[model samples]
Target chain A: EAEVAQSPRYKITEKSQAVAFWCDPISGHATLYWYRQILGQGPELLVQFQDESVVDDSQLPKDRFSAERLKGVDSTLKIQPAELGDSAMYLCASSFGFNYGYTFGSGTRLTVV
Target chain B: EDKVVQSPLSLVVHEGDTVTLNCSYEVTNFRSLLWYKQEKKAPTFLFMLTSSGIEKKSGRLSSILDKKELSSILNITATQTGDSAIYLCAGATAGTALIFGKGTTLSVSS
Candidate 1:
């Protein structure tokens, strides 16, 4: 089974520090998504990418957060001057086609101290 | 804004019991409804329904979509402890991203 891959299964950082997470979607999957999930809440969409272009990032905090899928295959999400409230699990998902079911990665759990 | 809502945020049952999870949505250009099972790590795809009146089934799990009401239900039969986890529902729209519901946490005890 082709699975989406994520790096740094867990990360701990001091407040105001920088953190970065990486994700590689399944091959041939054109749609990639980044989501933030709190302990008891469902995953919230942070950004969506389609073939190296951002389709939606309305919920992303541009001031401190940024995500890029340069070649449209792999993506990186970075947070500068992270805050305590930023602690959560970051999940990456992808689908071969739009409007289809998504396959998710194991996720990177970030803890901002 | 597109929205998805799930019911009975938490549920607890014993083995061999039957349980039903609900999901409702209000989305623009609604395309399909999907269900996923989340354990300790990543969520696994369970089912996807794009048409109404047709039920999708896999082993002990089955799901149906009601386009007229914009809702869906996931039914689990002969549940086991392994079924304890969060079940999520997401509504996908054409030319847009998916809108996810809060999810229902099911705990099936022995």
Candidate 2:
């Protein structure tokens, strides 16, 4: 089966440093999502993208986080001045539409010291 | 706000045992309920329930949704050690992203 790809399986950065994560959704998928999972908790939505346009980002911390999918295929999420509370598992998922089941990437585990 | 809640945050069972995980939701404009299995990395899709009274099954696993009750249940029969993982339940709404529950951790020992 086709899979969503993510880079930097693990990352450890100092507080005040910048961190970035990348994701490439499965071919033909038009809806992409970014979620953050804290230890012992379920994943929470950070942002959602439809093709190249953002559909929802209400839960994203705009003050320090930004995400873009300029080509409508691959996406990038960046956090500036990472905080200790920012440590979590960042997951990327994609689907043909909201009604379809989503395929999740392996995810990037981030840790801020 | 919209939310999904799972019961018995953790469970322990032995091989050949049957286990049931519960999930309840209070999402506005609810569309569907989904279940996933998480081992170490990302969660793997298990089942999706859209209409009530329709049971979805796969091998030894099965799930049913009750819209009237605003809840769902996942049943895993003859559990194996490989079934040890965190089971997550999520609720989908017509207007927003999925709302996930804290997840139930299941440990099936030999």
Candidate 3:
């Protein structure tokens, strides 16, 4: 079965540096989601994309975080001038559509010191 | 605000014992309830319940949803050491995103 793919399963960086995470959704899946999960907590949505356009990014920090899916298949999320609080597991997921459930990637664990 | 809550944040059971995990949610427009199993990495899908009082089962795991009470339960029977993992419950709203609970951690010992 096709699965969502993510790169750089782990990352470590200094505060005030820049970092990026990448994700590839399941084949033919059109809806993508990015979420942040802190230790001992559930995942929280950071953004959502429908095809190549963004559907919702209300929880994203526009001042420092950005995400894009140019061709509607793969996506990248970037954080400039990362803060210590930005340290968390960044998860990527995709679904056939809103009506279907999601499949998630192993996630990228970011650590800022 | 939309929220999902899970009970018994942690559990410890012996092999062959049964366990029940609970999840409750409050959302504006509930669409579906889903269950997942996480074993130190990505969460794997288990079940999705969209209707009330309907139970969905898979092997040793089963889940049921109660839309009227906005609650769901995941049951694992005859558990084994492999069944030790974190169980997460998520609620999706119509035309919206998913809201996940903190999850219940299950540790099945031999």
Candidate 4:
């Protein structure tokens, strides 16, 4: 079965540093989602994309976080001047559409020191 | 706001035992309910329940949704140690986004 791909399985950075995570959805999937999972908590949506356009990002902290899916195939999420509270697991998922079967990547574990 | 609540927070079982996990939701324009298994990193999809009473099954795992009751149940039979993981329940509305519950941690010992 095809799987969503993510890079930099783990990352550690200083509080004031910048960090980025990448995700490549399964081939042919048009809907992509980025979610953050804090320890002992369920994953929360950070952003959603339909092809290359963003559809929802209501909970994303625009002040320090930005995500882009420029090509409609893959995506990138970045956090500038990271804060300690930013430490968490970033997961990428995709599906054919909003209500289709979803697939998730292993995710990137970020730690802001 | 959409909300999902899972019961019993955690469970401990021995190999060969059967276990049932519960998920209840309260959301507008309900579309579907999903169950996922999270081991260490990302959550892997297990079952998606769209209609009530029609059970979705794969091997020893089965799930059913009761639209009237607003709840769902996941059943795992002849459990093995490999079944140990965190189980998450989520509710999806008319839109694409899903509202997730905290999840239940299940540990299967030999």
Candidate 5:
């Protein structure tokens, strides 16, 4: 089975530092999603991309977070001046279309000091 | 706002026991319901429920969606230690991202 790929399996950064995570969705998947999972809680959507265009980012903290998928295949999410509260497991997922089951990557665990 | 809620935040069962997980949702234009199992890292897809009154099953696991009640249930029979994990439930919207519930943590001990 094809799996979504994510980089930086673990990361620890100081507050005020910049960090970025990358994800490569399964081939042929057109919808990619970025989600943040806090300890003891479920994953929350940070952003959603359809091909190369952003479909929804209502919950994303625009002031400090930004994501882009230039080629509509791989995506990058960056957080500038990371804060302690930003520490969480960042998960990437992709699907072939609406209502399709999503496949999640291994995820990047971020720890801010 | 779209939301999914799960009950019994945590559960403990012995091997061979049967467990049931509950999920309720209040999402606009609800498209589908999804179940996933998380063990340390990310969540792995388990089931996708799209039609009411239809049950989806795999091995010892089964799930049913009730659109009329806006709820779903996941059943795991003959559970083993390996079945211990955080089970997440999510509600997918028609044109937006999925909204996940807090999840139910199940620990099956042998």
Candidate 6:
């Protein structure tokens, strides 16, 4: 079974430092999503992309966070000047279409000191 | 604001016990409901329910969706220690991202 791929399973950095996470969705998937899961809360959507084009980023904190999928394949999420509250598990998922089931990546756990 | 809610924030069960997790949603346009199991990292898909009345089952796990009630239930029978994890429920609307609930943390002891 094909699975979504993520890099740097764990990352720890000091506050105000920059951090980036990478994700490669299942091959041929057209839609990709990035989510942040807090320690005791459910995962919240940060952004959604359709073929490299951002579809929804209403919840993304653009002032400090940025994401890109130039080729509509792999994606990268960066947080500039990370804050202590930014500590969480970052998950990525993808689907062939809006109605299809999604496959998730192992996720990158971020720890800000 | 669309959202999903799960009940019994936590559960404790022993091996051979049956457990039921609940999920409810309040979305403008309902498309599908999905359940996932999160151990330590990412969540793994368990079920996707799009229709009402029809139950989806896999091995010892089963799920059913009720569109009218805006709720779903996941049942795990003959639980084992490996069943300990956080179970997530998510709902999606037409052409929109999935919204997740807080999840239920289930601890299946020996």
Query: Please, what are the lDDT tens digits per residue for candidate 3 over residues A1-113?
Result: 88899988999999999999999999999899999999888889999999999999999999999999999999999999899999999999999875678999999999999
Query: Model 2 shows how many backbone clashes?
Result: 0
**Per-candidate alpha-carbon RMSD to the true structure:** 1.1, 1.1, 1.1, 1.2, 1.0, 1.1
* Ranked by DockQ, top first: 5, 6, 3, 4, 2, 1
Number of the candidate with higher TM-score, 1 or 2: 2
Tens-digit lDDT track of model 5 for B25-97? 9999988899999999889999988865357999999999998899999999999999999999999889847
- Residues A1-113 of candidate 5 have per-residue lDDT tens digits of 89999999999999999999999999999999999999999999999999999999989999999999999999999999899999999999999987578999999999999
Which candidate ranks first by lDDT, i.e. highest?
5
Interface RMSD of 5: 1.0
The models' CA-based lDDT, in order, is 0.92, 0.94, 0.92, 0.92, 0.94, 0.93
lDDT of 3 at B40: 85
Residue A86 lDDT (model 1): 98
DockQ, all models: 0.75, 0.77, 0.80, 0.80, 0.85, 0.83
Put down candidate 6 lDDT per residue, A1-113, tens digits, no spaces: 89999998999999999999999999999999999999999999999999989999999999999999999999999999899999999999999975577899999999999
Residue A9's lDDT in candidate 4: 99
- Give me the displacement of residue B33 in model 3, in angstroms: 0.1
Q: Please give the TM-score for the first chain of candidate 4.
A: 0.97
How many pairs in model 1 have backbone atoms within 3 A of each other, for residues 3 or more apart or on separate chains, i.e. clashes? 0
Which digits, one per residue and each the tens of the lDDT, describe model 6 over residues B1-110?
89999999999999999999999999878889999999998999998888643479999999999877889999999999999999999998786588999999999999
TM-score of 3: 0.97
Which segments of candidate 5 are over 4 A away from where they belong?
Answer: none
Residue pairs with colliding backbones in model 1 are none
Model 4 TM-score, all chains together: 0.96
Q: Put down candidate 2 lDDT per residue, B1-110, tens digits, no spaces.
A: 88899998999999999999999999999888999999999999999888753589999999999888999999999999999999999998884478899999999999
Better of 2 and 3 by lDDT: 2
